[model samples]
Target: MQKNDKIKFYSCLAPLSFLYGIGVWLRNRLFDWGILHSEQYPIPVICIGNLSVGGTGKTPHTEYIIRLLKDKYRIAVLSRGYKRKTSGFILADSESSSWEIGDEPFQMKNKFPDILVAVDTNRRRGIQNLLSLPEKDKPEVILLDDAYQHRYVTPSLSIVLSDCHRLFYNDKLMPTGYLRESISNINRTDIVVVTKCEEDMKPIDFRIIEENMKLRAHQLLFFTSIVYGKVKPVFPSKACFLNHKNIGKEDDILLISGIAAPAPFIREAEKYSNKVVPMVFPDHHMFSKSDFKKLEAVFEKMTSSGKLILVTEKDAARLKNNPLVPESWKNFLYYLPIVIQFCNGQSFDETIKKHIITFSKNNILQNKYE
Candidate 1:
């Protein structure tokens, strides 16, 4: 976290990253020489992925794509289902829980009940399963979560997301730094999105990011933000939504979250309630016996201190399905629904729509002939 400590850390990773760079070169060479083949999907596959490990807001962007295309196209989302137990292709259903389908997929399924969602370690198999389904069930466009480094399949349109606060150009690969691949790999992306932008990004600041960024011939940049949901109240007995009348009338607010990045939730929670009791666990930490007990203790403390419990929609995504959350916090707990919003407004929408539609149409025709 400190400057000298970080320098020492990257110092260790530098040599290992150099070796890792060699491996990547060889792999790309094999594919280039036509020995190792890249798989192709029948339909247009747009990948929303990143180079880093956590907190780029890909899920919100993926959800945004789902929301945008739900009415027009038969859309499906494919994820590696990181940290999930299962190996084979798993489609989320009404009966599906986080344990079975993973956190993000289940959240997507719950958000857009009409859309199809699935997860698999082997993406090709997942695509095969979707193709095997009836024509009407087949997706016209499939969104792959965290597939930027996946060279096995060639995505029709690849959108690489980077945090504006923590751009890859400023950092290095992990062990060495935090990059998954080399700066040259940015060439693979069609569009580069600057996610989680500060609301008041200046023109000069935008230029600094672009100038430092390792860009290919036509790689585009877009800025986005987390659009927080409306502030609501916690009732005692029934499910009561918040309105103007009961804005700050809640007893107190308790913030609980389990996300790779809990900053957004904490910031938003603080905006509504100054006295917030925050409960955060590790990312993707499934509830264990002790974990549940800890949460119970935290809840008890909050209640005793006269605070109502509130959680991110993501934490609630898993907890609402499970029995870990006690009946006491059940009525009080709430989750925030976030969506990726472009700061530039219509210009951003137009650019994304233009590129995707053109890419989809062109890829469709090309695949039809091939």
Candidate 2:
């Protein structure tokens, strides 16, 4: 499918929303009645999710929180393993490949070895398994990636990240628009962060977003940006070089991205490279033999001679698993690790800390993540 198909736009299916609402209500009823079950992990669970469609910066934000809490707490990250070939709670290992766990979780495992990364389509089962891990490996808290819709496991702190560009409050439910749930669901979030802001974003932007959003009584609002700094080339054997500053410092970045949106990647790439050539793909696109040959041929033509190839951290996760990547090309293929740091710095972390503290004090973060 093309990129536009993935975008949540207003649909003519609004008449079926009554049916949609019924499905929503019945699903909740099942869990509420214990007919369908919910599992509470034996540790604190913090979830970063969006009520709408993609581009809320959930992954980077999740990585940020995980890194922040790792020093003081043993943490584990659980994701649905969204489009993997496998289906089960597969724990991440240095030896574990993305084929079994999918790219995102595998990427998480590679990025944070100290933390346990688990993937399963059934989120309820995933959390249960994590909680069941040995005491030493048992995390103080579990970070559920993209789990706001997984109603089975109730997180202690539910952080809802929204885009300043698109607020759910102004949108309609799925198929009708981007919203996964009704805008009223904002009430469920403990905090709302307007992600992907400009470095010099004015107060007017924040005011515009906040003014448009229908905030709940308990939800706190904040803004954040992508602090792009350096880009490192990925090689099969761990062989590479940088130009005093870094790789991708030169012009002409050919960006190969299989993500929700290529906009952010393009924007970041332009900063380091003179121009960006985006080879966009459907989210979680599986590379085919024909596709590989086609892309390699394209990359070969782009480079022409000297080393210059760049891929996002997500795409690199998949590439790392496949042995097909030539050792020589590995050194040329660059990947940049991005963290969602606030425009200022400590304020966002501090805000999260306060919410975590509150959860602890209220005993809400206890052994019941369900």
Candidate 3:
């Protein structure tokens, strides 16, 4: 069920949420008091994460950072590999599958093959492994994807994202709501981003959000909206050529998404076609043979002559190269790509670049003196 569908039960779960909040508070306090250490690395480490459990657009934001810095720096991305089958630190290679490295990481490796992508539950260990590489291969900067609560490694620049649709300020602790921790913890961040905002959001709406967040003078705030790219075939070899422009009112879209949030994706599909049938699944859900059979059944039942199967880029990562997917469905399977566009993009870019430049200069001076 969608998060909105569970809202009515939040009151009943309040007691459980309170207990969960207490445990979160104590753990954070331990780290704050230095009873639990947070390791600091010499190289620049930027974290893109959220206080909420999922659907804040962390992966796309991480990809944006990679695009910004990859030209000037050797970049490395470290993630927990959320639902992968493996358990140790593993760097992505040609042979790596979404089942092995997690879908997001696998997607990154495929999109930006030049950069380093590694996964481990231990953030510190993952960083150490990346740093141990030869000088040419060692990354100059490390991007931590979804490590906000994993306070074992202190990031040089911490960016926390909140979905505009479900702002953390309006949210509650787990069991009752989506927040992993208290909204007060947002004060620890260097930058806060409101993700998945409407492209044409009014100025008044922006001010309303800004006032509610109450960020510190030292913290930077930005708003970003999703920009859906062209529809690309998941299985290019057997795909029937189609683009977003080709989709029309007469079309019937069978949208298959295994993401935390599918509302936005469904809305996008609805713009082109009035008839949209969505098959929603849990985040990081692995598609099985039974699921494939259901998809086939659904697609075959659609009456429109112009019918297609649509999925998010993250879901496409898991479906790609899978043995269970039937060959007949390949022609209709396509995934939409999404990228973030900041309200004031130049300012956001400059802020990130300035920090990296300063870090590099300081590191050089320290090396000279030592």
Candidate 4:
């Protein structure tokens, strides 16, 4: 069920939320007081995370950072590999699968093969394992995916993302709302990125949000909108080669997704065709033979001549690897890739570059002093 559907239960469980908030607060306090130490690495460690449980556009934003610094630095991304079957530091290689390193890390490895991608639930040990590599193999910069509350390793730059539709300030603690911690915790973050803003958002809207956030002088705020690329076949086959944009207006689309936020993706697909049918699933839901049979039944029912199955890029990652899915369905399956476009792109880019360069200088100075 969707998060909004659970609102009635929130009030009934409001008291539990109070206890959850206290636990989160106490843990952060210990870290702040040095009772819990945060390990630091010499080179830059950039973290992309959110205050909420999910659906703040962390994957695409992490991809944005990879695109930015991949050319300049030897970059590595370390994630907890949420829901993966394995444990410990398992590096992505030729034999890695979504089940081994999680879907997101596997997706990143496919996109940027030259870069390093590893998964370990223990952030400190993960970093150490990456650092233990040969000098030439070690990454000069590390990017931590979904590691905001992970105070075990202090990131040199903490970029906390907030969904524009569901702002953390407007939400409550878990079981009551989506926020993982208090909104006041944002003060600890160095950068605040408001993701999924409308393309036509006005200058006054930006100012109003900025004022509402009451950000600190040191916290740099940036706004970004999602840009959906042309839809391509999930599994390339000779029989099916048409892109979503190539389809006629009269076409029917069968949208299948297992993502935290499908509203944005569904809206985009509707723009291409009016008849968009959704086959929704829970986030990170693994597809089974029964699910495929149901999807097949749905596809067979669509009487329209121009019809195809479409999914978000993340969903495509899992579906393509599922052996239960018939080969015939693969020919009809397609996915749309997404990227973040900053509203104030120049300022955002400059800030990231400056932080990285400053860290480089500090590393040199520290080495000389030692």
Off by over 4 Å in 1: 1-6, 231-239, 243-251, 303-306, 355-370
Estimated TM-score per prediction?
A: 0.90, 0.86, 0.96, 0.96
**Reference-based TM-score, model 4:** 0.96
- Runs in model 2 with CA error above 4 Å? 1-13, 16-18, 25-42, 236-239, 243-252, 303-307, 326-328, 357-370
Tell me how candidate 2 scores on lDDT: 0.76
Between candidates 1 and 2, name the one with more favorable lDDT: 1
Clashes of 4: 0
Cα lDDT of all candidates, in order? 0.77, 0.76, 0.94, 0.90
Clashes of each: 6, 3, 0, 0
What candidate 3 gets wrong by more than 4 Å, as runs, is 1-8
RMSD of each: 2.9, 4.1, 2.1, 2.0
Ranking by lDDT: 3, 4, 1, 2
Per-residue lDDT tens digits for candidate 3, residues 1-370, read: 6787676577679989999999999999999999999999889999999999999999999999999999999999999998999999999998899999999999999999999999999999999999999999999999999999999999999999999999999998998889999999999999999999997799999999999999999999999999999999999989977878888888989999999988999999988898899999999999999999988998999888789999999999999958999988898899999999999889999999999989889988999999
Model with the higher lDDT, candidate 3 or 4: 3
Shift in Å, residue 215, candidate 4: 0.8
- Candidate 4 segments exceeding 4 Å error: 1-8
* Top candidate when judged by lDDT against the true structure: 3
Extract clashing residue pairs from model 1. Answer: 13-175, 13-176, 173-177, 173-178, 173-179, 313-336
